[model samples]
Target chain A: MSSQPGTVRVPQEERTRAMRARLLEATVECLVERGFSGTSTTLVSERAGVSRGAQLHHFPTKNALVVAAVEHLTEVRGAELEKAAAALPTGRRRTRAVLQMLADHFTSPVFTAALELWVAARTDETLLAAVAPLEQRVGRQTHRLTVELLGADESRPGVRELVQATLDLVRGLGLANTITDDARRRRRILDQWAVALDDALADDDLQGETA
Target chain B: MSSQPGTVRVPQEERTRAMRARLLEATVECLVERGFSGTSTTLVSERAGVSRGAQLHHFPTKNALVVAAVEHLTEVRGAELEKAAAALPTGRRRTRAVLQMLADHFTSPVFTAALELWVAARTDETLLAAVAPLEQRVGRQTHRLTVELLGADESRPGVRELVQATLDLVRGLGLANTITDDARRRRRILDQWAVALDDALADDDLQGETA
Candidate 1:
């Protein structure tokens, strides 16, 4: 009998990585479904179908587990956004497409889970300490990605502000969708913003030409 | 000394109203200071400086108390908004003033309390049923007021959507403020939005002239 590299014996490191992924995924699911208050280590372990010992070994506390899970999910979602950005259409329709892609990202399950943590963190000092820096990093990355996707020139007088407004608008739409299916209204709002954004950018181009 | 209307004797109805207002204000303070999960009836009563008996008599359950408190505060805040709208500059600066007022409203304590409820209600069926309608009414009122303040013609193409986007943007700004002050960033975003809004409205006027 001989053991092969691709045989039944999974590498210890690979097994540990897989287990942690499952736990993190389960934590996000719990956060989205039950919110922060309802999520617990035991529940996450049960949902992940991992032993309590394994869960503790991976994440010693609920705070650590949740923070890590959200960070992991945010990284995964950011990668997805980058991939989606590659598939976006070019030319006149690109502005609307970019806004739509952003709207989709904000309204996804990971965003919902993050919203729960954000609200919970508001009054939880320890959680706030952990979550605030994570949110700032995510915010900066999202802003940078948006600027790149839109080919926005921050050198323009109002272009930078316009980009920030776009992010805030999509985030607000995401919050609106949490209580109700605001998709129709969100679509209309994004359509309007797309035109405004294009006009602002066009004005910036005019300024650039004159300069 | 016969009892006089303005004298030492406060009417039973007046006293009851005052007590309830105190309790409701206290609840908002609690919700803002201590997230939804941290807020409790006992804490609310203690903060309000009202007897437990009176608190229980007024609001039998936590859900009922929080719902009523938020509703009460929203009405007060809405009235305040209406009052503030009356004093808005009626010239070139009106749009910026209107956006600023809205930004203030969304970032206020009452809105913070509503946000806590909104997040908690995501996973809470009973709270959802109670909050959804209240939020809808508030949202509609905010939109209507924005339209009126801007003198926006809904019949014009994209006018209504632009207004809705304004609300959503301000709300998103509010969400950002929850994590940190975000005031400087918010001001720049609102200023950018103000210019975009003016351009859209001006375009609508141009179309009106053509028609």
Candidate 2:
């Protein structure tokens, strides 16, 4: 490849970026498969096919690696959610569609990996410091996105709470799924929620007009 | 005290039962304070102030100790929830009162201890086998209690889901509280949900009468 005239040499910075990405990705995988306690720098480097020295150069310790992975996990999850949001259908089915998207996000591997960290962070002060802020940011982002997607009118009574309830419901369902396959029960709950949400939002619109 | 004529000698069975309770309580404490990875049989024995021989005699392994602790934790939590339910006010504010009770249960120390076990169980087959069945039983019991407390008619369409959504919402709030003091946010969400629930249940009653 270096001999080819058209092949431009990859910059050192780009190489470093690519290596870091691999390491972070591997770290998430390890966290998911092996958990926080079981995951190690050596295992991540081996999984990423990167040398131990290079892995160390990027992330000095396991905590450092996990901290970076937290950001990466949130970014990947946020991007995926955004992409799904863009593709949602309009009209009567939008509420259910939006909810389905949120549920999918919560049940994905990234969320599972995040769950591992959240549990581990509860006891580890260093990890807690990093995870708590990112969790809040991600949470606020999800809440804002849900509000926009549902076209909820926050000025109306109970609208903001309804939006929050939707997020909390799905997150709880996600937690349920972590233990067992909760798909059938989850589907029933979501279906019922969609109807209730539509009625609540429509009622709010009516109130807005009357007031 | 043993020398007193009114004081009867404790039976062997009673002594064993008391010893088991101490160990189980200590196990929950260790799980909450130290998490799953940090919890060990030796630490639990020390915390319980029980001899190593007695701890080993009761629980041969850490897994055995945790498995027993799962049942003990559920029983303790269930007993507390039932007691709280019995004291709830029955009136216009009953719905809110019930939700507050549920929230309190989810945010309690027992729930936090269960959370540690749940996260650990995700990567452990033996713990999963024990925790999963117990979790289902507890879930069903909670759901049944919620239905009874709210006087919800399951025959009404979406009532069952509403009951479940209520549970999931509170559980999610509890999860949020694990990281930060989410009491203010939780109060608002619960307040909003109480209103929404009253409306839904009332609407169901209206439909039932008109039909």
- What would the per-residue lDDT of candidate 1 be over residues A135-163, giving only the tens digit for each residue? 99999999999999999988777788889
Per-model tally of clashing residue pairs = 0, 0
Q: What are the chain A TM-scores of the candidates, in order?
A: 0.92, 0.89
lDDT tens digits, residues B58-123, model 1?
899898999998999989999999999999999889999999999999999988999999999999
- lDDT: worst 10-residue window of model 2 chain B: B202-211
> Alpha-carbon error at B122 in model 1, in Å?
0.8
The root-mean-square deviation over C-alpha atoms between each candidate and the true structure, in angstroms, is: 3.1, 3.7
lDDT tens per residue, model 2, A13-128: 67888889999999999888878898999999999999999889879989889878868978878887888889999998898899889988888878888888888889899989
Q: Could you tell me which 10 consecutive residues in candidate 1 chain B have the lowest summed lDDT?
A: B202-211
Where does candidate 1 stray beyond 4 Å?
A: A1-10, A204-211, B1-10, B205-211
Candidate 2 lDDT tens digits, B1-211:
6576444555666888999999999998898888999999989999999999999988998988986886797887888888888888989889999999999989988888888888888888888988888888889999999999999988777788889989999888888888899898788888877877777777744322345
Q: What lDDT is obtained when candidate 1 is compared to the true structure?
A: 0.91
TM-scores across all candidates?
Answer: 0.93, 0.92
